[model samples]
Target: MRERWRQGRAARRAHHRRRGLRARLTRMFALVAILAVVLTTVLTVGATFRVLAQFGPGVGADTAWDAATWQQVASGAGRSIIRSAVQAAFLSALLAIFVAGLVTRQLTRPLARLADGAERLRAGDRSVQLPIPPRQDELRDLTATFNDLTLSLARQEAWRRGLVADIAHDLRTPLAVLRSEIEAMQDGVQPLDGAALARLHGEVLLLARLVTDLRTLSLAESGALSLEPRLLDAEEALRGLAEAYSVRAVEAGVTLTVHASSPLPLHVDSDRLRQALGNILDNALRYAAPGPVKLSAWADGEGTHLSIRDDGPGFRPDDLARAFERFYRADASRTRDPQGRASSGLGLAIARALVEAQGGRLAARNHPEGGAEFTLTFPVPSGEPPSPQTRMVTRAPSSSR
Candidate 1:
């Protein structure tokens, strides 16, 4: 155990020896400059010694100079050169240290600020704004990334708070109604009968549906949703969705129709696809004007496209942008249906999430002809070639519509 502890301590010491960016960079510049100065000084001294040796004693015997005099001259020249070189090296080292200190501080200040901002963010302060410097460098890129992270976190925090509030609001209405009805019945004010019981049952069902929708959304958001994908008839899927919602549409004084253009085959999660399409149809039936809601499916070179168009007051221009945001309703009028039943605003958001999870895209637009239309597009899966017979097939309008 002692040996193990000692090894751990040694490892930590080694980790600390690996210095941060500024210290490492400063040491690098200082070492390079010191090396240059030392090399220059050494070369200068060596050249001086060589020159002195060449002219001294034996080679100068023919000249007037004696061996002792030559030795003295050589010795004096060598000392002077050595001293001069030492002084120059010392001065160079001082300059290197000063320059390195300046450069290190310049590079490290931005990173220090970034570290502090990160800590603040972790502490739940989303208002920390990092001012990006004008310099085109890694620090600028880092600052920009940090800024985007801050903005994203702020938006997510806001959305979280809004979701909590919306959920509470939704749950409160049904619960409050149930409590009041039960209390009234207990006090002999409202008698227990078929009528009163049905009202209570309706509230219970509404609560159940809201909880179910929330669960679906949660699973889809967390990437925990299980999907079973297979190749299936796209036309059949559309017709199935239309038939499921046809009764509700008729009761709401709206006509629902499905127009299949061809033998459209698509690889998708059949049940999930149905849920998404059903949500779209339900939304149309609830909010659209009393007119026909058309569902159509067609195949093209790109892939398969399914559209649901409703003859209603189309989405407001501003609302169109955020139509898929969870718990978002365009206005108060959208809260309840004509029969005073509440609508869970998570339908479109969940539908989009489910569709995208299956490698498809869902989009909404104001149809030029009259109302709002939602289009779902899925690309042909890889390794699955389009069938040669899958040509564009448009059927004439059915006489029933």
Candidate 2:
């Protein structure tokens, strides 16, 4: 394998040597310079001879020139023409050299800076920012793209650090609970009763759930999450989910309703889609007010659209921006559910990832009237993408409600 890799690299280098950009440009400039010199010499010699031919005969005819006089005139004229051609060739060569030098300098400097920036980035420098080339050309575009890439990588690195911290924090609580309980029982400070055993079991469950969610997210992000896609009726899916969550909504004292403007078809991984929808529905039911939470479906030119909106206190402005971030909770200090159960905060993040893996988009926004709305747009195989046109609508809060 190593030998094959080395051979492939050598082949590529040889190919580049024959047709590299810099080499091609250098050859072009050399050809142009040589042609300029040749043309200048030819034109200068021809013009000089033409002038002598027209003037030399007048001198011979008017002066009764002898063979010696003719020889002197011809020799001087030839020397003059040769001198002029030499001077023209010399000037052309100088100009060509100067232009070639400028071209090489302009091309090589930017490329060197780009290479240096890449090296710095590889060495873990997130602050590397390449200056955009001034010329409005492909090189300028390349520089701009490099800057964008560096910025994106830096942001991803920061997010990764935050994820690690969040995961540690999430794991610490359950592990601490289990350790404390076991230690207490061992010290005879606490009895190993049903209550104590149940508490330990709950902590284990929480840890299991957190681990599973982390695994799912990792798989989705890495494109390792497999999907079994089928043609699904979008309207039916929405109705079914709304029905499934209705009981939870009732338990939470929130009204749940499903509305389908029209039937729409979609090709998707049903189980994955349901998992994503369940998370969204769970969030809506958890945070919504006693008013109605609507799940609606419709078809547009862009494909099928499903939205879940609640009349609850809308997301805090800051939370709205990063609600989909993994392990991100709005109330950071309040880490438990309303029932005081531990929460992983991976629901929306997982939902977004699963939806995206199946060629869909999941987004959240506050309803204009009052509340948060989560919209899932799934593109049909035969339909246009939702990016060009969106058909989700925001309704005003009813005064009567």
By lDDT, the best candidate is 1
Name the lDDT of candidate 1. Answer: 0.80
Q: Over the stretch 215-327, how does candidate 2's per-residue lDDT look in tens digits? A: 99999888999999988777678767766665555556666666775446779999999999988887776666467788887767666888889898889989999899898
* Model 1 Cα lDDT, one tens digit per residue, 10-123: 775565455534445667787867776776677677768766676555554466867787778778778767766777677777777787688768777898999999999999
Q: Which stretches of candidate 2 lie over 4 Å from their true place?
A: 1-43, 50-83, 289-291, 339-341, 381-401
Span of ten consecutive residues with least summed lDDT in model 1: 392-401
Q: TM-score of every model?
A: 0.81, 0.79
Positional deviation of 110 in candidate 2, in angstroms?
2.0
Off by over 4 Å in 1: 1-61, 64-71, 300-302, 339-341, 383-401
